[model samples]
Target: MKKYIGILGLLTVAVIWGTGFVATAVALDNYTPFQILAIRFTVAFLILLGMNITKIKTISKKSFKRGSLLGVFLFLAFAFQTVGLQFTTPSKNAFLTAVNVIIVPFLGFLIFKKKVPIKGVVGSFVTLIGIALLSLTSSLGGINLGDMLTLVCAVFFALQIFVTDFFVDEEETWVLMLLQMGSAAALSWLTIFITGEGLPSIKMETVFPVLYLGIASTLIAYFLQTASQKYTTSSQAAVILSTEAFFGMLGSVLLLGEKVSINMLIGSIFIFIGILIVELDIPQFAKKQG
Candidate 1:
């Protein structure tokens, strides 16, 4: 039952993050990237701060330092993602950002001397093929500015994942999460000022979407992710979280009316299959024979 509950929580996180693509697109209609991120993270930070007030006071200095570093990585990940959206469609942005799944194994290899499994290599190839099909239009043949920004976002996200993995074992997770949220919010606001993007007066339409991004997508999803990880392996968590892309594609189609072509559908299938190969430990079959 506990395992099932954890799966439900993770699935909910994916769904919220998926819908967040649409919310972000709507919010972007009236706000700058920094302004939108600032609004979202600010609300999320405040909520987290309130919940962790007692624990926040008791966090060790070392934990604060590590959490702040994690926050910096998280800030970079979202900052690039938010800015990239200014130059790209939400569907394209989501798919490109999802490439972190391919990036993570390489990061693990470089940082921890972990062996890259054959299945992971094949999965990476398949995912890249899918990304190509998904991003290419009849008019555009290769990468564009938005795609480039999202690729950079994917790198930062990979770094964020690694950093979180390091710190999760060393610090209180909620305290770490609060610090990360606060730092992201602060950095986003600083960017807003530096870029001369003043906060526009909030409209009724903007209010709900921004709140949803902060509370539902950022805060609650993150909380669930942290909690779920306590009961599951890191690989399992990554596999579950990778479904964010699937949900993002579904939400885009249903809510934003984004078209999914036959090529795109084929690409998505390859991506999912690739992820399954990696997550299910299919490479272990080769090891058994050898």
Candidate 2:
């Protein structure tokens, strides 16, 4: 069914993004965070533009508006996350950013008047705990400016997901994707200028990782997401998409030769449990049993 396809597509996206952790580690060795963001979006835009050149004639004003709005949210989410990392530990930044899983369902209710599913609410909490276990290091620290910015980043990411769900069916998927990337690329370059972040040297070491992130993470993963959201509710999609953290941990082990801890194993178990709770509509089963 389409729902299963959507779930599969989103899982694929999560896997690709999880692998992005490794690519990002390599890319960040040479490039500033903003520089990586700029190049990644720019390369994604160029590739998407090339692929969708003939389809450009079909783009409409409404579609462009919607796509551009998504681009704004996408850029803000990345921008905030990058800046937030400067002040917060990577663990806290990652955990705070994952809070978008909880925000998406509420955002839908508040803005669109959609009825939220009970399973999604429960799954989100479980997933939050899972992410906490996975990403949190050392003692829980006091909240700070970086934490607030990362939380804002989470909100923008939730917006990006909901908006993509809203407009994917209304516009040409490929063209919608193209405009979104093009808009983000423009914003990223502007941010680079404002921050005075210079571009990294063009070298095999940096370019390859950036190219992988652009082509695999931005271009392909987002196209899959935009297409997949049409077949699933945003709440369900959010839960599924969050498996990226688990996959990121997996990538760290396999690709980076890091050892997994018991905490991580437990965290991965809870994450999959959360995914199954959302995917299977477990609350409905509970009601039937009662």
RMSD of 1: 2.1
For model 1, residues 1-290, the per-residue Cα lDDT tens digits are 87788788777887888788888888888888787788888888898788777776698888778877877888888888888877877777777777776777787898788988887887888888887786666666656677788889888877766566666655666887888888888899888788887876788966787888988988898778767666665566666777777778788889889887787788778778777777675647579536
Q: What lDDT score goes with residue 202 in model 1?
A: 86
Question: Per-residue lDDT tens digits of candidate 2, residues 129-168?
Answer: 7766755556675456676787799899889998888887
Per-model TM-score, in order, reads 0.92, 0.83
| Per-residue error (Å), model 2, residue 201 | 2.0
Query: With candidate 2 superimposed using the best TM-score fit, by how many Å does residue 235's alpha carbon deviate from the native?
Result: 2.2
Q: Which residue runs of candidate 2 sit more than 4 Å off their true CA positions?
A: 83-97, 115-151, 258-280, 283-290
TM-score of 1: 0.92
* Stretch of 10 with least lDDT, candidate 2: 87-96
